[model samples]
Target: MAMDTPFDEFLKEWSDNIDKVRTGAGLLSKIRDADVDVGTTPKTLIERRDKVELFRYDPIAERSVDTPVLIVYGLIGRYTMADLQPDRSLVRSLLAKGIDLWLIDWGQPGRGERWLTIDDYVDDYIDEAVERICAETGHEKITLLGICEGGVFTTCYAALHPRRVKNLVLTITPIDFHADVDDPALHRGFLNVWIRSLEASDIDLMVDALGVIPGEFMSSVFSLMTPMRSIAKYNVDLIDTVDDRDKLMNFLRMEKWLADRPDHPGSAGRQWLHDLYQENKLIKGEFALSGRKVDLGAVKMPILNVFALDDHIVPPNCSKALGQKAGSKDYTEIPLPGGHVGLFVSSRSQGGLTKNIADWLTARDG
Candidate 1:
């Protein structure tokens, strides 16, 4: 209970420095040796179209759900997130729960894809994928499981062609983009406000000049949303996990996923930032694709809206707005604890999220 002497304090400082050096060396060794390859769950490529590829996962369990679920990930990031690792994979988790799973990979859009608009994605790419899944499964209707921006695509597709979708599942998606104003919390919805602050011409200029929005550019913008955490992750946060291989591997895997963001097509990028983010078109029932308006009321299929309680990119309110606007009499909203990506990767939410989705789809499979 007495205060430490100068010698004792010096010894403590020296010991701490030694521990830091050892931890740093261990981290470096792991970084050099660790297999950080993501989206590793075994899957087969079933179809391909230009930059998009559709994959069907080999079943790991007896199929309980008659309808197949097609996961649609936005161009901003790769679908590898859903299967970041065997232990924390949403894809594997759902598969283990006896769900037939498929995913659409919007493979790394390049300069050549600059002219591709959202219409091309929703009406062409997603529609073609859905049709292919249907034909393969021999099911008249397949479930659409869309994540983030992909959720908007599925929503549009569902609203436009309700009969094609048996069920609609959206995770960490934004419906009412401007709904962020309701909370105005510093750590949440910064992306929405930032996009809204820009002029339409600003969006146009950026898209026109770049041809395609660079993945690094969007990653930087996302980092800006939580500037402090983004910086600390490499130093303070990483050091805490250096001594634990499992924990350190998880961190490295997540970093691997983040580093693999794909460029978004220019026209689609423009519509996303300008029409949706700036104009707040989707919820207003004004967002259109292929010359047809996307009316939320047209989303009459059973809807499962899973939102993160602490989502910084897409605020909870923005996602929750779907429950009220969707035409489905059977609308469900799940508010899970985590930020945007954590909803899929965090161990705390993975079990419940997958179970909820599996159960929801199972209930409606008949």
Candidate 2:
């Protein structure tokens, strides 16, 4: 072989870049053609109601704890993110750690379901699911792990029926809507700021216009919060992962989840915006669901309040208040490095988040 000249080396670099471009284009084509599979975790549907289902994942490991952990995802999004894939799945990680896992899938809602309120979710749907899980597992008390908006519902459930929940894990759950009023973070949560500007009449008109809050509308609002994210994700980010088929597929899986948001009931949505977001009633113990008030002090179970250090949607201030309000003497606050969604599926957080949850539950499961 002859010694390579500078010009030849430059040509080789250009050729490699061309190959990378080809790979990126091929991955993009696969996405456009719908040739990818998303949310492929194997599970068995144990219970079903009108628009909700309780799913129990098949054990990933031989060993498991007796106290089952019930996972309640927010009504705004699907629970598929918990089990995005085998390698990066929170459900799989928990199951492998010998922790029994159960999840709730609040199926898509219709206009008729607009009357469903926070009370119905906490009292009827969530309470019934907890009962079924307890009945099936032969356990008197189960652990509750709530994500985002579901964290608020779980907090209410645990407060209302403290005897049923043995341990509570809240990840990126917003307790104080005004937590970030003075935060310097550019994305200090547009939801918090926007809600402050709306009046009762404004909320009523918006709710009346759409009997049930449209998932698409909510998606658009989040999109607007990070206008450049979509562009960078499809272009720069996709190009970086395109060469790695697994990474490319994982990116697509996340996108698929984001695209599959669920509609929120109009009445519940109105209450969430006006009471919790606008008035910050949950923390003040003034928020009522069905006919009962939610007292955070009643959350006396062994508590693990986790928040993303750089979370934009739910700021650190929003989630950080859980530890102070909850009555549990065993409360622990974990401010991990990641954004709101990153805490779930990002590699940087997937391990720490799941491990912290498993370890905390193990200590308190008895």
Top candidate on lDDT is 1
Clashes of each: 0, 0
Misplaced by over 4 Å in model 1 are: 1-14, 23-27, 30-34
- Tally clashes: model 2: 0
Cα lDDT of model 1 by residue, 1-366, tens digit: 353798888888678767975986776675663477788899999998897899999999999997999999888899999999999999999999899999998888899999999999999999999999889989999999999999999999999988899999999999999898987576788888888888888778888899998999999999888889999998778777766777878888899899899889999999999889999999999998999999999899999999999888898999999988888999999999988999999889989999999989988888
RMSD of each: 2.0, 2.8
User: Candidate 2 residues 215-257, lDDT tens each?
Assistant: 9988898888888996798777876788787888888888888
Relative to the true structure, how large is the alpha-carbon lDDT of every model? 0.90, 0.86
In candidate 2, which residue pairs clash?
Answer: none
For model 1, state the Cα shift of residue 259 in Å.
1.0
